[model samples]
Target: MSTEEPATPQLQSTVSKPPKVFSCVLCAQRKVKCDRKQPCSNCIKAGVSCTPGAPPKPRSRRRRVIETDVAARLQRYEELLRRHGIKLDELDDPVISARPGVASASVDGANSSHISAVVGKDGLPLYAPNNLWSTLSDEILDASSDDERDLAIRVANQSLDSEPSTPPKIELELFDLDTPLPDLSSLHPEPLQIFRLWQTFLDNVHPLTKLIHAPSIQQEISRASGSPQTFTKPMHALMFSIYSCSIASMRDEDCMEILGEDRALAHRRFAGIAKKALTVAGLLTTRDTMVLQAFVLFLLSIRNVYDAQDLWILTGVAVRLTERLGLNHEPLLDSLSVFNAEYGRRIVWQIAILDGHTAGRARIDTSRTLYRGDTKFPLNVNDADLDINMRERPQEHPGVTEMVFCLIRCEFGSQLHNQAAIEGNNMLRLLGNPSTPVAEKETFISKLERIFEEKYVKHCDPAIPLQLLAMVMVKVMFGRLRLAARHPRRFRDRGATMSQEEKDSLFAICLMMIEYDNQGHRLPGMHKFMWHVKANFQLDAFVYILNELRHSSVGDRADQAWREILECFEHHSDVLTDTKNPLHVAIGNLALKSWGARESMLAHLGQTLPDGEVPRPISVLRSQRSVGVSPGSYSSVSDQRVAGEPTQNQAFQVANPTPFDSMDSTPIDWEYWNELINASGIMIDETQYQQPVYDARAMNDWK
Candidate 1:
């Protein structure tokens, strides 16, 4: 018990102790256990650049020692089990669920192998590579915002209408008076052949009648697997072919082809094609397609292949696309500006003149001297001049009517801005003529007036104000208001030589537009409409209309137009009222009031109105008297109509009420007024319609 063991002394090593190994950065940052399997356990744990400490030399399991005791026991057990009733192959292999947190135990532990990677929802192998799978997963999981969707749509839109690999071939058909002559003056026989080929091409294509019924081929191509640009190509090509056909129709198609072919019937065939093509092309909302179509239309117009109608249709296509896609885009405006500047004004004027011709119920004399090249007011036509009679004589041309229709469609229905400027002036110039005949002038003025007061007022946006003003000016010119007010001395000095009725009429028209404000008289839509009209039609035509209305002479178109307008207004007074157009109603009432007051004109107006109801002008005056008065005062009061009213010559004085007299009159009596006030109530104003006449005048002066 007391014996002690000998103590051993500590031995010092010559080398210093080895430094501690650090974990790999990845594992250390995460504070997770690492295999440390690379160069060292620490390196594997950190997920750092790990390399095998040495080459991965395969180990021979065969060389390892066998557990003979366990092996012998297992083999003996298996042999005894097999004799009892069990087979070694009968045991089923174990499987693990794909979901994590499943059982770890496996029945076949004797045979172990690593599991294969998993597949993802999008059918891609998600577990194959860590780097690639994460990116794919993030994209698949993230939702797209509204702006992203729009961006994608825009990207698709921008790609449509790229030029085809082939040089965009076209086959133009010719019909009687339809084919377009090559710009080259040289006559050729091949053009006719080309025209026939164009017709044949259209028949084969079986052009679309409506956009909703796009051909099966076209629909299929758009949906095919290709870029949007490629998809829209067939449509664009079809449209171009149609345009070519329209151009051909204008040529002398019936003229024997250089090869002796009669292609007069080609026009109808090609027109059909053009219509279908336009319908298909319009389905596209992409910027590139819109611009291309606009450019093509412009070229056709300049080349005289397409008339005003064609230009109008083409313009509609461009404007609709631009609006649908959003006009703020730079390319759209750039293209529109070019089209607007080049022939824009001319097209507008043409439409205005067309409106004048048909609505005014007069022959629009394009032959009248718009200008003489040597004169200060040059009668020269601009490049934009789409005048139907520019190179032709005064012979009645059927094309003139067509051209007018074209102008109307283009200006009124398509490019509204152009229509406002041109159509307004053309209407006024035609209506203001002294010799225009009252019947014709009245019809024209009435139609023109409705478009502004009724149509434009309700839809005030766009260039409606300009249109409204134009209508107003034409109305005044028909009545000779501007000329009489500005140059009263001319009427007084030449009273005996010229027609006094014509002078008086012009003055009356002017008075209606020149409302008493803080300032002197002014013309509505005059400056702006004139600016555009003068830029295209003969500048003097505008000045001349004013001058003619002022001077009053025999055979004066202004005089003729004034009479025509008054007569028509008297005829359609009731129908005009339903329009609920304030301007039209006001003018109608004034015209009727003047006529009913005159013994001579009363008979004329009586014949115009429905079976004997007092004219509106007389009715309005009576209403004003009883506006706020007793109810019984609303009676017909036939007594006042018979005695108080002045004759036709004196009738004009109502509009010329002295400033003091007008101020003395009380505001309209709302209670006593029934039908008159009722009519006014139904009228919807396009503009605020609240500015005092003076304010509009001041702005006019400043301008």
Candidate 2:
């Protein structure tokens, strides 16, 4: 069978012999199988001629990467990035690859070897703060391209390097730049005094401010105790500010009791030293954060020492200093350690708070640019939870921490007016918005109040002084916000009379607020904060209560109103006698008028005490002396006034009547008083407060 086998046929195309047909070219090109016949099956079916050709040559080894070749290719890529103004270092952003007209090449920005930034949880790269004049990085990618990122970093570094946020250089007699710096060793408190001053600050100021990390600061104090010379200038400044502030918080009697120094003498001595220390520390141009801390403490502690307007101006400088330092730019902080970042947030927030309060008191709206910041809120954890070397962020504590007072206050300001949060709901705007209904405002306030109560207030132990302060402050804030929701202005703008029930509601709240104010200041353990209490004279409550007493004279409401009024005056006896301000004059007139109305109504009704003891309000009102009015202002009101006209014009028979005046009745102008009250503004339970408009230092106006 093999002898007669098929002859060996030579394969050919129609035109010529195929070059040693390795495979059927027609089938090979078409990627189909061939039967190896003169006409392949595919061609046979298609009815076309089949062509044959040799197989393609074997593929050589893939070209190896040579230096020049690789370099040239990389240069081409870098040129492309540069053309788009995108740098290799900032190529962490995939958006660059998608920019208009960017040729879509094989390179993928996400997976590019050029990017080395730490990918965040959301897949974007986290930006670290950059150095301005850094040497070429060892990283090849950074060396490979120049882009916008490098330019931006250079600009930022230049801003920080330049004299940014420089407050006017502090100038003091002992700190003349032209002269050699004076010896400040005597300014340092005695070794025992340091502990006492530090402890006093912890008890009186630290709980409210929470600016300093207690454990760390205490450690630093211990390390530098025996050798005060070792303390940095900024720390020294902070120390002197602490000394002045502690002395400021105490009454002269309390200072004598605790530190055995007269309050006025101690505060003057320490405050002067603090000013000198601040000047020496170069607070105006220093980039150090500690210098800013000392500056803030100094400004706050000197509230009563400087004019209110002067304090307001100084606070503006602090704010500018904050911005120039990039404390408001949160991205700048991403590279910082956890503890440092947290500390920066605290300082930034405290500065903002002080700015608000000072501007409020001065009735001058300065810059409020901090409101637009995206900085994250400080975590609510105690000082013990943070440390210098911490890597991972500490979890926030669930219960009341020492930061409770400060955090709540910061939260309230940031959300309500400051608008510092990136996504914070403007619940405060609702309280003051003209368009919002009273009911809706109340509902929103209730929700917010519940959050404060559950998160902070409920966990507080009243026995703790700070917690007690927080409790009263929270109530006062909610009450004020609620009152604002239903304020007379809300109805007045539309020319609507507040209904009897609304009037009663408003009356009760105003009286209640005054009561809270009295209670907050008069509590047995609240003496330490009395300086602040005395500084923040809540006159609006008095104004509103006096107006209410004018319309409604003799009911239980009047009795309660009279009681709160008398206690408030007794608590702040200095306010009753000081009449320099027109606002104070108006306040005095309203108080006397209200008291006269009470006596007349009681006298007409022949009302008598169930007990022989005179009512405390009556007794208090009669005994106190008021400015421009004699101590004899209430002399006509007999304790046994069961008949006849009682105390006729007794409250306002000017002690020395001017001969030119005809039967004068100094009727209080409600509109003018309204404007004055608006100017002497009340903040919502802030951690820091500004000095009152009245001159507190020279007059000893604080009670």
Candidate 3:
């Protein structure tokens, strides 16, 4: 072509297209521009040839179809649900979790799969490519053999079982997790005695606690009693705990009559054995649920002997252990037998109540778990109704069942616990927070009372011992809470504005607490719970009445209050004659001062107490202090007073101030007061009543 152009003279008229060119090789290698000359400017600078290169291949753009993907997924789900006979439109119904006609959870019977279905976040599973369990399970499910498929289904149904994760072997040897247990034959009571203890537990502890499945455990206890050598560690711990609780619940005279053994000696013996059994059972680390049950039972039995503060801390550990076992969550119970699941619920509920009670006793904040626990209350059913072999949960009883006592208590406890956990539940909290209208508090309390009455107390048959206990206990708690809601300190931070009517109401409520407790002690049917009643009788109510009588002038309500007080004191005369601890002596001294005031007022009014006679408590206290001895008083408690009489004056006065005495003008020491109450072996209740939010104002002026 060049030659022809040069010769152009012979010009062929047709022109040929030149070959297309892009960046030069040298420019391309340097990622620089090429001028299209055979040797580009960059190449010329480097004194190298610029080789031409082809253009880059075009990149294809991908179109995003997020809406299309979502639609497809939704369609796929709808089709799947349709094929499974699910009503997609009904998916949003509120009652789906608790559909009609389904039985509630049961502790005794095995639970069959529910006919109603619930969708779960994890239902549409997408197994990872390398997940070994998922792959193996899928293979098993796909197997042609019916045995393999059945086995796979069975394994899948056990939702309680976590996926097996292969962990690195721990070959290091330092301590023995499975140490050889000591010979426990001696700890095992005789077979006949075991039956007796079992019966006692069923009669006394089971009705209130309802923690044990009586029928299932009865057989185990019978076998274990005769053959201690055959006992598992957890069951062994449980058996000993049962014996300890039984003996602890019995009175000394009852123990002597029934077992021909001293109650105190038998309790100490069995309780010590129970401690050993818990240690052997590995409660802190064991995954077995019975170990926790045994631990809780042991705590309950030792309540009278154990320090409240330490017990509270120990229950904190129990609560942490409960969380470790995932008991506070409900869905984790999926696939478990109805008996096991319901018992698990019972265990956690009991632990919660114990934790709350101990915290109340210690006058401290309750466990935080109370605020957030989602575990449902135990189904209202009897011990005989729950069976390990049952396929479905039994229907909840409409009337009373073995669990009725626990159910009612659990409901009230859970609500109050959660309420106090967030908003300060006590009136004393007004010191810090803007006070809630007092009327609002009364409204809430009245509503609570009505709900409690209609829902629980209405169904109770007072003729039945357990039902009567429930009714009385609920009313007492309501009364106590009502008093707390209307405390004098809440009227004004310093109580200057407390009306006489409210003061009278408070006095009446305090007296009522003592009266109910006295009644609990008096009733022959309530004899089993007498120990509990006596131990938990609050000092607050006692101290309040004494303080009110001493510090405030009486109104028209005083006569009735005085009569009730003396009557209650007469019923609980055991306190005056039983001990001389500071709390008790303070009671003695305050009553003395309060009685003096009452007499003066009576003289001024030309009247006298009930029969113009010295009350039993006042008479007994005066006689004890004057003579330095009283009837049946040389026991462990009152003996301390008689022994230390010389070092301290027998005459009680402001020299030894009590919790109600602020004569020194010093700030109130709640901690010291709590210690005094604890030392006196009085188990206080938390219920937002004790552990009052201290006010740093002028409340120290005790009158």
Candidate 4:
């Protein structure tokens, strides 16, 4: 039994075979020991999910090969520089010899001594300060060949061209030496009339502008009106501009009429007086804040009346004057009265906002001229709390007011304008270098979407002022529209492939903008100038809907969207008669044409009308349907496009139900209509549809 020897005790392997190597994949990759468990100790300690797998293969080592040619070339260059008594280190040290005469040889005595010992120079150190050639030697050597030097110069020139240049200063003579201030006594309304106009201005225009301090202005007007005191030209101008804007904003026709004169003509006369005073008084050179405020008021009064080009120039001049007064710079807190400083800040920010807004509309770049720096935003305090000596902190929980809303709008516009400028520059760079990676463009777009979400989308509170709400909506929609415009083909392709949720979001944004515009007009103290502000936003929405209809694959959805846009336009038809707002009128006319064309197309498709007539005017149909519904009622357009129901035209009859129906006899020129449709980029088979009969009466009224 002993000889059997327990099967001759197989020699126990002394080497413990490398302990299984059963660590999780992550631990193994990191070369850390892991306890063999479902979730290994290392993974649990590291707070990572345990993923166990077989040991990973070791990565092969890559051999590093030195470039012999490059090393030899650099050695030879260093040797050559040394032979010429030029040390490479000396040429490379920009801090030592940055200029012609100043050179920092050493930071300390010991270093200075070491440098002197190494270079065999006493006190002179390694390099002299007066040697300008030391810095240029490397460049000179590198650019030895003529072609190389030419290339260097060309690259330098390209860099210079790419860099933004400072704009030249504009100097304009403020005073007319020959022309005197116009006698404004004849133009000035009576004292009672002035008081009434001032009250109207306070109610309608002052809330929006807020450029003037009401207390100061009221006191000035009272003192000036009390006696036969001679007022300064600028004061008179300010009063006239304020009154003119007041009268212009009055909705009542009789209230607007002054001294039995046409309201618009009377305002124009008052504005002319203000202009003459500004010129004769040399207000530009005076850099008077009151005069500037008056000028801005005058501009507001004539916004819809003047050519856009003239307005743009005038605004630019005002901005330059503001900058000249140092208003663009934040006032030192201790240097001026709190009221004066705060007012100055408000005026500058207001001008900057106006400048950016106008520049955007004009499609011009004024960012270079518009100073946007560390200027403080005005405190969100009401005028009553602000006085000459007292500085009031804005309430932590301030209620929404006209001033507060305007400030919010101004801030939003500023940020949006800056973003647009940045994106524009990036796009230009991409255009210049077509090889930019697609991932970079995608990242840029993602960032823009994030910005929109954070800035505009997140701040949509119903309690905010309607003007502010509309402005925010417009900013968001415009940003998206512009992004789409940049890649029209891509956008179209994406729209074609978009899911139902995405399409709904697009439609919802368009619908929301239209709805907001309609809602804004209903608010009390809503100014006419708001129409100018919302005009582009409304038109952009219209364009967005049209684009969707033109490109969407879903016919039913497109029809529903088109019907909604038509209904929105029909509801706001009064805008067509607003002669003062040409932009609104133009948009209204386009909507009318689009609606009429759609109705004609449906009629041509043999869709039965409600009255069983093939060719009744759209106005008559709209009036019949709107007879019972409230003007502000929001009916979903999709509901109207029922699957089995007759087309939208079937809902109306030939009963003349609208003011527009009286003008239906005037025929629209078919050629012009076709041009408008084509210009809009909507592809349609015109031959399949008859030219819609234009109301001669409406056309005459439009003309």
Q: Best lDDT goes to which candidate?
A: 3
The superposed Cα distance between candidate 4 and the true structure at residue 549, in angstroms, equals: 4.6
Q: What digit string (tens of lDDT, one per residue) describes model 4 on residues 556-596? A: 43444554565555545534332222233234333333444
Q: Could you estimate the TM-score for every candidate?
A: 0.22, 0.63, 0.62, 0.53
The whole-model lDDT of each prediction reads 0.30, 0.58, 0.58, 0.47
Instruction: Name the TM-score of candidate 2.
Output: 0.63
Question: Where is model 1 more than 4 Å wrong at Cα?
Answer: 1-278, 284-320, 324-655, 658-703
Q: Across residues 240-322, which tens digit of lDDT does each residue of candidate 1 receive?
A: 44334333433243234422434434443434444344434433543443333333332232222223222333433443443
Query: How many clashing residue pairs are found in candidate 3?
Result: 10
Distance from true position, residue 660, model 4, in Å?
31
Q: Report the lDDT tens digits of candidate 3 across residue range 1-703.
A: 7756765543543345466778887677666778877767888899866667778889955323344334424644554454354554556767653454322221111111111112211142211110000000112222224453343233323221342211112121112343344566667877888898889998888888888788889788766677777888888888989899999998788788767889988888888778778878887887888898898898888877766556766777778877888876777764577887898888887877777666655544443323245667678788778899998999878777877778776677544433444465543342212256556665556666776788778998988888888888877777766655665423322344554445445555676676677677778899887666766665677767765654432443444446666777775666575432335554665566556655555555566555767766788867654523222221121111101111121112112211221111211222223334543435543334322121122122110
Residue 537 in candidate 2, Cα distance off native in Å? 4.2
- Arranged by lDDT with the best first, the candidates are 3, 2, 4, 1
| Model 2 lDDT at residue 676 | 42
Query: lDDT by residue for model 2 over 160-228, one digit each (tens)?
Result: 323331122234543355334546665687788788888989888888887888888899998887788
Give the residue spans of candidate 3 off by over 4 A. Answer: 1-181, 367-372, 417-434, 491-494, 551-560, 570-574, 578-580, 602-613, 627-675, 678-703
